[model samples]
Target: MTETDVVVIGGGATGVGVARDLAMRGVDVVLCERGGLGAGTTGRSHGLLHSGARYATADPEGAAECIRESRVLRDIAGEAVERTGGLFVQLPDDDPAAFDARIEACRDVGVPTETLSADAARETEPELASDVRRAFRVPDGVIYPSRLVAATAESARQHGADVRPNAPVTDIVVTEGTVTAVETDAERIEADHVVNAGGAWAGRIAELAGVEVPMAPTMGVMVAVDVGGVDSVVNRCRPPDDGDIVVPHVDRVVLGTTSTPVEDPEEFSTDEAAVEAMLSEGAAMVPAVADADVVDVYWGVRPLYAGDDGGRGRDASRGFQVHDHDVARLTTVTGGKLTTYRLMAEAVSDAVCERLGVTEPCRTADAELPAGDAEKLDALVEEFDAAGPADTDIVG
Candidate 1:
């Protein structure tokens, strides 16, 4: 039997982050995961460290938060991030009105942007389509999810947290309207409070404690091609849709994605046509990708918190939500982007700490996260089997 002040379910970036935060604040925390750390959504992201330009039009506040967090990640995890700035390019077929709106919204939200002429844009990225209408440079960058997750988990372990991988939480024991313990396959963990950080499976985790987390999971695909010379993250300057967002890696570029709603996150079908569409769409911005060989492809499900009106797919909020269950000590945090995982953890920890009578403030934002050379970081990822499909080419 194991006992702790907090039992955090899900070992992704947010889950480990919660554990690390609470543990640093002197809370006994244990993190349990069904598979390896980041084996879920965190491990399968397109690796864009957003500068918030993508959501500045529709979501200014969220965009602001992204820009703030993006800078913070660069400070804390410099070795894990590639400082490749992002560019939102307008193609010949893209809406001219939308381009104007995007630039205005980003400026209004205090997101630094520089609109570049076609010639200048081509100079920044020579492989850009010769017919490129225009481009906006933003602070977008790439984050290696596997290294980030492994680094955070290592921080949690160093902070005296019981970070357990391969620990499937079978059930959450809520007795008499109070969460008393969490039941896993190996042992029973008696926890003062339980946090459901299960990402897309958050609804299922809540169900175990007799709560409803309205998660409308949306599945998307990412295709990585063996192309080079794309020195920055590239996005289509239009409304959110399929086959946009090109994330550059050291050796290849990852092109994605399609947003289709799904009933079950675990069981969903992928479209091969989506991959072909991504290559075609990607070539619109960077012509070199048109004939590039695909190095990897992976599917990811977004943990969308569907409210009453049921905003589906891209319409669903990319913001995080904290759900307090009928049970006294059960909390579930879901949604939000990989760029803002630290902020999400802070919010989750604040709520849990408030209920637990802990007054310690969050120190994750400014704290220097510990990381090492490539070999050591790779070892951490291997230790947890957390080489996410999208990070396969980078981690090990």
Candidate 2:
């Protein structure tokens, strides 16, 4: 059995971020993942760096957190983020009064938003339909999830953290209310602290430690199109709904998404109906998308805690919760959006350090992640571009 100061479950962004943060603070950490790193929700998102504009109307707090983290992430992971900005458009039937409130809300949170006329909006994005009633630009960007996860893992490795992929924790060894070790198929690793950051599988991990996590998993589907229809991220200035946002990533634009509640996280499938629904709704925002060539389709699961009203998935608070199982020496950090993952990690690391009596303050905010070699990145892009099909490994 290998002994470490902390054993982190889940190889998604949250888990890898926690591992990197703890290891940077000089804690001996081991991160175990059942599959490849970021082979979960982290890689399946719409890849938009939330400018906080999306949640400005409904959830102000969540919106604020997103804006703050957006700046930090842009500074740290320059290579993974494309500062393309975002456009929130209102159609003929859309309410302008609500759009005003959204713009005001964004201003309150220090997010710069400017209203654009129909012609001006078209000037910015020629592909936009002529019926665009109102348009506003916010400082939004796109994030490459796979690159972000790989960077965090590299940072953890640089700090002497051990990362084991394809190693699933089968059980949590507890003795008299204290977590002593984590048993995986390959080995049994002992730890003084355990953090469950498994995205969709968080509940199962907690159950292994004899604890219950009220998580309601929902699957989201996103389809990518070959046509370079839009340059900036386009969002419908309305409440969260299916296929409301189109994010341009690298060489193509990703049109997403569908929020259908599901029982099993790993068992859901992205069918033709879901794809057709996304494309139809997506075409409303950008008319050219109607004829765009569909390249690939993927799905993601959001782990939302079951609420009092039985609201699941996007209906639940975009906020996160941190549970400190003191007696068990375990901490579970779940929920929250992908844009604020760094802050989530900071909070989780702080809790773990406090439990272990360590007084180190987190410096993850200002830390700059190591970037991939420029030549290597360019070569990878060239290979994907020349591979004939746009669906080739351009993302990973």
Candidate 3:
């Protein structure tokens, strides 16, 4: 029988992050994932390291968290981030008034913004719409999701945490209103605490523990085109909308996304309409994107929490919530975005420590993850290099 102080279910960024934080604080942790690391929504993300400017107007709290976390990640996880700053372009057709508000919102939240003229913006990003009226630059970048997860998992393991991928949690052994063990396919692992960082599947895990977690699995479609013109992350100057953002990764530029509620997180399929809609919307920002060949089409499910009273789509609150089932000794961390995963982990870790009576404060914000496997990274780079220019650059 496996024994541990905490059992973390899920291997996405947040799960691994929580394990890393707890393990760093000298808490014995075991993280179990049903599939390979980053095989879920974390891998499907567009790789855009947010600067919080996107949500500055709609959700300032989330925006603030993102900016602070963004800087923190850049500091501690520098190797996993690409410093490709972001730009918000306002075309002549877009509302110029909204641009002013966005700038103010970013400023109010401590997200620096620099205004640029259409010509200046085009000079920086030639693919930007020629009719652009103004542009604002934000400290955005791209994050290597797979590398980040792997590094965090590795750090957790080094700190005496056990990370077991492909070990699905079959059941949560609740006895007398408190979780005592977690049943997996391989073994029954006993734990004093359980953290449900299952992302989209948090609702199912919560149900197993006999708790209600209202989660709306929302799907967003992203299309990758085999063309790279814009060098920075580009966004529409207006409110959050579908396909209004273009993120340039390694070789291909990723265009996305459309948000729609889905019944099952794992059962959604990509369709031609969604792909076309993304392309059509993205073309407004980068005209060359319309002519580029589509390299891939994928979708990611966001674990959007639908409380008794909350909005959906672009209106949904991006803030994260931690549900501490004190009686059951289980915690569910859900919502938030990739950029704010660190903060989410910190919050959840704080709760876990409080429940366990551990007074260790969170030091993940300043602590750097151990260096990644250099030989493995070199081998990957060699493989991608031999595969030709079509392969997405897998730089760490």
Point to the candidate with the largest TM-score: 1
Q: Residue by residue across 1-396, what tens digits does model 1's lDDT show?
A: 988999999998899999999988989999999999998999888989999999998999999999999999999985667889989999989999999999999998878999999899989989889988999999999999989998898888888999999999999998999999999999999999999999999999999998899998999899999998889999999998888899988779999888899999989888889889999998888888988998888999988989877899988999988888778999999899999999999999999999899998999988867765777888988887778877788776
Residue 129: error of model 3 in Å? Answer: 1.9
Off by over 4 Å in 2: 269-271, 372-396
- lDDT minimum window of 10 residues, candidate 1: 368-377
TM-score of each: 0.98, 0.94, 0.94
| Model 3 misplacement above 4 A | 371-396
lDDT digits (tens) for residues 1-396 of candidate 2 = 899999999988899899999999999999998877777788778888999999888888989999999999988885767799999999887888888999999999888999999999999988787899979999998887766777777788889999887788999999999999999998899999999999878988999988988788788778888667478999998878888998886556788887777878878766788899889888888887788788788788886766556678678767888887745789998888789999999999999999898888888888887655544433433321211111233543
- Comparing 1 and 2 by lDDT, which wins? 1
Q: In angstroms, give how far residue 327 of model 3 lies from its true place.
A: 3.8
Each model's lDDT: 0.90, 0.83, 0.83
Q: In model 1, what is the error at residue 133, expressed in angstroms?
A: 1.1
Better of 1 and 3 by lDDT: 1
Q: Which stretches of candidate 1 lie over 4 Å from their true place?
A: none
Look at candidate 3 and give me any clashing residue pairs.
none
- RMSD for all candidates, in order, please: 1.0, 3.2, 3.2
